[model samples]
Target chain A: MIRVQSEAFDAGAELNAFSTQAAGAGAVVSFTGVVRDVTGGLSGMEIEHYEGMTEKALGAIRADAMQRWELADSLVIHRFGRLEVGEVIMMVATASKHRKDAFEAAEFLMDYLKSRAPFWKKEITADGADWVASKDEDEDALSRW
Target chain B: MQVLYFAWVRERIGVPREEVETSAVTVNDLVVELRAREERYDAAFADTSALRVALDQELAEFDAPLSGVREVAFFPPMTGG
Candidate 1:
């Protein structure tokens, strides 16, 4: 499952849901991305995404993850709109028979989402607000995998 | 067609939303269609090098055809969390 939402989500609650859905899986790995107080010297963040298109882009990311890993189940949730620091901004859950598959799949999904998804984030700092672009390193990380 | 902009592309284009009509059939063709409209569009698309596109909300390649697509979006590489 994949979602692009505007409201915050409970990581524990979502993990429970994923575990419940992955009845036959032996391992589950998940990651929750939160709004950090600092990024590349920026103090805050504001995320923006095209509503209808965000969903489509995230779905493709999820589909690719499934194809790349032998995952029994997976879920991806991303929050849009204004977000305060320390709030949950995104989550990815992957379940497989072994921890390696689950962990690597989740990380791979996050890397692709960070670079290829349609969502854009703007950094708001003491100086000014500026739109954040995917870095060359970020792209290289995905390409290397 | 509905043309939407996101991130810095929206700021550079000076608008978040717009409606356009064109006979272009692919994402690249559509870029050409928008570029021909005015200088602002040309400037916005000046460097396709830094841009990416989506058709009907899904990430798509420049060669992807646009037939029956309801929405087209253009933005730089994502910085998603």
Candidate 2:
């Protein structure tokens, strides 16, 4: 499953729901990204996403993960729009018969989500706002898989 | 066809989307036509390397043909997640 929306979601609830859905799986791994104030003076973060393209990109990535890993099920839920510090930005969960597959798939999903998806983040602070630039490390990480 | 911009690209162009009529054959050609329109477009498209393009919601190269593409989007490298 893949979801892109502006509303916030409960990560615990989502994880539980996904685990329940992947009933017979022996292992499940999940990652949740939080809105952290990297800069102390930060007030909030504004996330802008391509409405029609966001879903499409996420779906493609999810499908790719499913194909590459021995997984029973997967879930990706990402939120957009104005978000305050400490809020959940996104989450990814993968279920498989073994711990290795679940762990690898979750990491793979996060790596792709960081660069491939069509979403931009703007850090808002007392001074003003600035668009978050793509890090070289993020791009370099893709070469592994 | 429709042209769309996002993030700082939209800020520079002053619009999120627009309808375009062009005889351009490829994504690069369409970009050149847009750049010739005004200073804002020119600035937004100043460096192709700093931007990414999509055709009909799928990512595409600048040299990709636009023969039947109905939508073209330009924006910076995504900083998602």
Candidate 3:
């Protein structure tokens, strides 16, 4: 499943929804990403995305994860538009028979999503606002894996 | 074709959306076409190192073919959490 929405989502509810349905899976690994108070020294974040394109991009990323990881299922949900601190911004769930596959797949998905997704985030700080750059470290991480 | 810009690229270009008609067959070719538009396009694409691309919303390579693509998007690397 893939969703790009403005409203904050319930991570616990989403994790339970994915895990409970994966009866054959022995392990379910999920990641919940929230709006942090500090990002690259910025105080707040505002994310913008083309709604239709955002969902389509996420669907493609999910499909790629499915091909790379042996999993029972996967779900990716991301929020767009303005977001406040401490709000749930995104989540990724991977169900697999082993913990390693499930955990690694979820991590891999998030790493790719960071640099590959269509969403753009602008940071508002005391000085002013600026769009965040795809960190070189992010690409390095993806390359190492 | 539909052209979309995001992040600093949008800010630098001064517009978020545009439509263009061109015969470019690859992403590299399209960038060359756009760069010819004006200083903003030239400056926005000055360094491919600072830019990334998506074709029909899927992350794509610079050398990727653009045939049959309805939308082409340009932006810097994403910094989403």
Q: Clashes per prediction?
A: 1, 0, 0
Each model's DockQ score: 0.75, 0.95, 0.66
Per-residue lDDT of candidate 3, residues B15-61 (tens digit): 98898899998999999999999999999999987888888877789
Better of 1 and 3 by DockQ: 1
Error of 1 at B29 (Å): 4.5
> What TM-score fits each model?
0.85, 0.98, 0.86
TM-score of chain A of 3: 0.89
Q: What is the DockQ of candidate 1?
A: 0.75
Question: Given candidate 1, what's the lDDT at residue B52?
Answer: 89
Give candidate 3's iRMS in Å, 1 decimal: 1.6
Per-candidate local distance difference test: 0.84, 0.95, 0.84
Q: Please state the error at residue A42 of candidate 1 in Å.
A: 4.7
Tell me candidate 3's TM-score on chain B.
Answer: 0.96
Tens digits of per-residue lDDT, candidate 3, A99-133, equal 88899889988988887677788878889987776
Which candidate has the top score in TM-score? Answer: 2
Q: Give the Å error, residue A128, model 2.
A: 1.1
lDDT (Cα, tens digit) per residue for candidate 1, span A60-101: 778888888899989999988878777898999999998888
For every candidate, how close is chain A to the native chain A in TM-score?
A: 0.89, 0.98, 0.89
